[model samples]
Target: MTGEEFQNRLNAAFVFEGANYGRVHLIHGTQDAYSQEVLQFSGHLALSDAFKAVFLEAVELMNTYCRPRVKAPLSEHYPQFLARLANAFHTLCGAECAAIRGYPRPAFTTLRNVFDDVVLVSASLQKVTDFYKIEGIDPNGKFDPAAAKKARKDEEFKVRKLMTGSDSGLSADVTSELSKLNDLFDFEVHGGRLSLTDAMAFMKGTGPLHVLPKFVPQTFAVFMNRFTEVGWAVHRLVPAIQPPGVSMPKEWADRWTLVDESFEIAVRSLSNELGMKVGDAYAEFIKVKFPFNAGAVFPL
Candidate 1:
């Protein structure tokens, strides 16, 4: 769909939310706000209507197929639920789209990597919780049941400390870096959830590739490489904004670096193998337009 037509559709979709009309109108007026440049620079090539349809369908299928396999309650298994959805999205899309034949392997690999990361992180957190349960040591080095109850409130803190030694004064820097790396694979933060119409607008920005019947591995590779770079950049920059004295465990730090290095190598190899030019195009576009939307575009 043409940009203008897509914008109208989006505006219409937001009509039910009376408060969103003015913002929607402004978004409609600013072509650049919903332009191809935004999509390319943001490494958001997967934001197409076709992708969304396939993704939602896959999510439904996963809910039907994988939900039963999960032993935990739905709330507790949210991350697994999402991992399954992502897996289903990749599997169904790959099967339905002929173009995926060329890119299927890498694309499938990427999805698997993301799924594994989620599972790994979740498992790590669970292990830490189990360790605390068995050892009965809280962050303050105390063993009070009341404190333990309160500690559960900030579950992420416990997990973060265990994974990165946030309390030990060793793994702070490394933890920060790993956090940045994690963002690269996180879609909710990077791709901000959208209403169906807005999602369509974002997808339209991907141009003709979205409508294709097959996967474009090269395009996916280009987008992922940029996304990964942005994550690293955020990690490097955060220390400047907030002086770092946090500590991480040596083993965890080394393993984190190894993972980061592997991703870096994979990104470079994929770029060369796919002959992706999206990164260059994105760089050029950002050089010219970043100044105008500096606040909206860049955040560490």
Candidate 2:
């Protein structure tokens, strides 16, 4: 199906799903809204039908990625798990694009934030899964050994290189999760050195890579900014709609309590993850030293 057709189907399916159950459960509706926003934001370029298909595929991708293993159960901490998945997609996309484009180390703060987000989500999921297993939930069908191993290996490789600075030709200042990959390997895959233009073209194509549209750092940031806004809105609306005795997770509860105090910390964390100081000097450097010509692309 075309992109538009896919998107329409996705929208319809989600709307139906939401309408059918959302009115009864504030959590369900809020979650649905979050998912729908992600779908819409990521697939904005596609035709509606195609976008829906792609969105479904993305969800399936998440399921596949998080499928349970023989030894461990899948986590029931839905929000944290979803957040991690989102951050992972974003990090991978940015790294791939930078590798392809030969961009001089995009900020590391975003990538670090992605890593931290994933770690938190993964930990929360693990906790939930463990809790369920101990409580006699069906534990056999929740873990995927191979996928888990791959994820661990990928993360290990990334973290090691980022922390140790082993790769040559990578900038010494490139310390963020996003910049770390540059040191580990040359962006020579898919024939010649990968460029951002080529990466964008490849991402706009098909399959798992289709998610690349959502993962690429520049676009991903825009999407994330939107997600944060939506999340804040949902958080605000939740109290009004929530039924009595619906207990929120401790982490979320804590976040709400310290939301004001955490804003600056969050900004700093993001800055470190992207590897750029959020000061005016850096902004000036980009404007004066690295002025973009007509065709030159600025990275996210």
Candidate 3:
């Protein structure tokens, strides 16, 4: 859609109870306000409709907190990776849509793909020292071949360094946030859940031979959690206006713990039942795995 159209859909619309010094929009998620405000949008809304309210609020918050705050373009920092980032966001929107439609398999699968988007953002930050080396980007952005190559083939060790805060001048909070996401992203991308076939079979109930719920709302929540987590990395990487004041939303593991429980049962049981070789599973979804630690990747 055109920039004007996007603006029309997303511009400063009051949502989930007007944000206030006295109002309570941030916490409790304002179930009543969610409908009264967000559902006010009619017609075929942008795919980002669900999170637009919070995202715009985040922009304002970042501007308020970012130091050396500049209204310069985001592309200034990510000139070499703009197109890929857009593609990732677009596909992530699709995943969000799938999640809404109750397709857990695609929701989780596509979430894994977008994790690469997170790596792309992190890697570009590593490659560029200046915040505004590249010029602005339009809605239709150009491809950077180098970025495309590195995003696909960059070593896990290097990516982990940036993500885990072993490199890059990132805050402990952001790196800590990223480490949690990256390890989980690795889990999905590398078949820690189940293969697409297995997923389809499990859904159909023809293979697993057990009745399971067709969909889980938490599946969508899991995808959204990653979206915001990566978005957190991107927001910090951009030139500062200020640091965030509102709490970063971080509730994926609660839902995912349940999903993983089912995953462990179905995947492990099926692997044993079918006599499936570990080699086959690894070969299907292999990506290099990086070592993560208690302090860096997970914390008690």
Candidate 4:
């Protein structure tokens, strides 16, 4: 199923499956209680459609990568990465849908979680790729038992340092984008900053004279930003791990192009909304559209 179609299935599953339903329950028709409860997530129909369309393609590529015919399986840690990535996608889709339904406070939380998942993609990169590791840690020279164990525990699944430093696993632009995202929401992620209640308070603003967020395009951008970066990494990592006798698939080539296009479309949308110019490198990769039939994209 396409990402959009999958989203619809998830929504339907909820009504039939009850609490076991794993999809966003977005209602249709005119502005009603369910939709009015949340803000409309995006008014940029073309951009929104583009994001979902490419995300579907990325999902297909991931499934293909998981079942390789020639090489050994992807890294042992890859399943963890996929689990988180899929969850992030689910959260992202849910958050955007929620915003369209009018519940943006939860979308804030979801956006923060999405950033954490993107960071995971960076940490898992070295594990999944075919690159050799030269251990910088002194395996034999260690002294303290408890301290060593604690240190090892602490070091698990950490890629922020490597990403920010010299490993260069992620492109410099992606690294920079993540750094900015981290800085922007550091307190929020740590539970020091805004809560859904606090966001509601902001919306409620000063005893009935309320202020509202630019919910539509802004919420869409938040969702797109998180998915595009990590999606690009996970999508691109497949080809980077080909074994010696294994040939790359034409599917990957097409998927790679689609992934890049998706990422570019997202970045360009951000730029346009922010009134900034698209960078030259990404400018070259820009496409007019990643077309899809919206009517058929989701069967609900």
Instruction: Find the candidate with the highest TM-score and give its number.
Output: 4
Q: Superposing every Cα of model 4 onto the true structure, what RMSD results?
A: 11.9
- By TM-score, is 1 or 2 better? 1
Model 1 regions lying over 4 Å from their true place: 1-27, 31-34, 39-44, 47-58, 63-121, 124-126, 130-149, 165-176, 179-300
The regions of model 2 sitting more than 4 angstroms off are: 1-58, 61-76, 107-109, 128-300
RMSD of 1: 18.2
Clash pairs, candidate 3, are: 65-241, 65-242, 65-243, 66-241, 66-242, 67-241
- Report the candidate with higher TM-score, 3 versus 4: 4
- CA displacement after TM-score superposition, residue 42 of candidate 3 (Å): 15
Q: How close is candidate 3 to the true structure, as a TM-score?
A: 0.38
Question: Per-residue lDDT for 189-235 in model 4, tens only?
Answer: 56635344345645667443223333344544454454454344433
Model 2 worst lDDT window (10 residues):
291-300
Alpha-carbon lDDT, every model: 0.37, 0.35, 0.41, 0.46
Per-candidate clash tally: 13, 39, 6, 6
How much is 161 displaced in model 2, in angstroms?
A: 20
C-alpha-based local distance difference test score of model 1: 0.37
In the range 31-104, model 3's lDDT, one tens digit per residue, is 33333332332311322442333334434444464323434434333334444544655676676555444454
Candidate 2 positional error at 71, Å: 24
Error of 2 at 183 (Å): 14
